[model samples]
Target: MSIELKHLRYADAAIQHGSFRKAADALGLKQSNLSRGIRTLEERLGYRLFERSNGGVQPTLAGRDFLQSARRILSDLQTIVGAANAVARGTAGRLRLGFYTSLSAGNLRNTLCDYARRFPDVHISALEDARSRLFADLRSGALDIAIVTGEPGAEFGTSMALWSERILIALPDSHSLAAKDALTWADLKRERFVLSLRDPGPEIEAILIAKLVTPGESLDVDHHDVSAESLKSLVSAGRGITVVCESCMGSVPSGMVFREARDGNGSTRVGFCAYWMPANENAALRNFVQMLEERCPPLQP
Candidate 1:
């Protein structure tokens, strides 16, 4: 016969207190009722769990073994309950995080590190991919949340403005502009611009046109569907100069140099946001999203 949790709890309390009356008083049950419960439990196991005397109740040899197991079982059950509570409170569980390229070095990295420290029990699985794949995984429920560039899309149930990085010009070492102390948009006017043919590529081009392009003047940009690393390789070969976020400077090739652009209003920056579906039922994801909201609130207009 299977032993019930109530039986185990009753036995443990009686053994710990060493008296049925005391255990019953502690558990707020009648002494007679506690004694009868123990009897029923012992009968089911076909053993005498306790020896009674004028001194008090003491465990029989067989009762010692049974009571030890009962205590251990109760302890394990308590631990399980505690863990479930932690999950419900958003302090423990698994978080699936998806991010686009170049997030590991900047604010996203710092934010994740802080989150892991704050909620040590949360198991975060981070994946990096292109914006298209990131958004797709977020939509399909393969990912709980995603850190992507540009504004949040219509598919996102909730979104937060994470951070932004100023745009820098990536120039080849041999390029004439590399010798200059600083670069400006006008400096790039005559230069060929290389851009990634990804989600932010068009966005970056638009920003360039808005900030740097003069009225009725044409800007030449070469779009390559490649990674930032690949883009650096192309830049090192002197294919064309490209604009990138400051966070990406460390990843540039040896022969390439990143120079700050002279935009007084600081409009030459790439914005990033975190997106998640409102229907996601994961407690860990909710916790992470709440933490992100606290850390990076939306920028006021």
Candidate 2:
């Protein structure tokens, strides 16, 4: 006696229409077939589900209980199907974007706005953290995609250098270096420097240390958001100078000046790269990567 969905469906229709003839019409089935299905269902359950009357039909206690469960099962099944369809269409899913401090301004913000406008149903979220944390989040599936500063030897499922811009030196407007169009690394040899401490990759720090007399005199600020603000304040107060990506100049506080670093190979550029898990195949993530490449072409390695 295998239970079937058609049996439950027939039972529900029969109860709704109050007679087998009417239920058959509603279901587009012959009256005899409908009556047989109801009879088989009642027999399998060892109970009389309905009381036949000349005027109408009424459900017995068992039929009433069965109808409740049948409706719930049907509703749940419909929901599952709808969710599957939504995912297939690239809508109604969550996307976690990993972004580093430097990109919060120009490229990252523009890309996010475009993605949101095009896919309004997708749930988009951002995790603003350092490079190392962003990579960790991607590896753990906490993030679907990350925009990080380039790391040469790090393991990644897929990565591309999105863009690069020269590093700039921020100084007080009254500082001696402010008179120059650009200041070389040598110009800041004796100047105090402020930098973000978290994951400033050894390669970049080593470059700065090689040019400065006392690289340890550099201040370790928490994150870029804080570091940038604090650096501007320190510069305004004539406490120190800092080196930052040119993009940071847009938000620099008043009384501070920004100039390209002299030793900066016009290409002493910071790289923006994207990373994702190779094995975790997701349509939304793939589409996002494509969008990034389309919006901002990658720089040649």
Query: lDDT winner among the candidates?
Result: 1
Best by the TM-score measure: 1
As a TM-score, model 2 comes out at 0.67
Name the weakest run of 10 consecutive residues (lDDT summed) in model 1.
99-108
Candidate 1 residue runs with Cα over 4 Å from true position: 25-30, 209-219, 250-252, 299-301
* Tens-digit lDDT string for candidate 1 (1-301): 9776787777889999999989999999998988898998999999999999877799999999989988888899999999999999879988999875564367787888888999999999998777779878888998999887786657657877787887888889999999997877778878898898875667778878886788788778898988676788899999999877766765768799988887666447777888888899999988888888888776678
Position 157, candidate 2: lDDT: 75
Supply every candidate's count of residue pairs whose N, Cα or C atoms clash at under 3 angstroms.
0, 0
Structure candidate 2, residue pairs in collision: none
Give the TM-scores of the predictions, in the order they appear.
Answer: 0.86, 0.67
* Deviation in Å, model 2, residue 149 alpha carbon: 1.4
Q: Write the per-residue lDDT of candidate 2 for residues 87-150, one digit (tens) a residue.
A: 7766667788876545435666678888888778788888777777887888888889887666
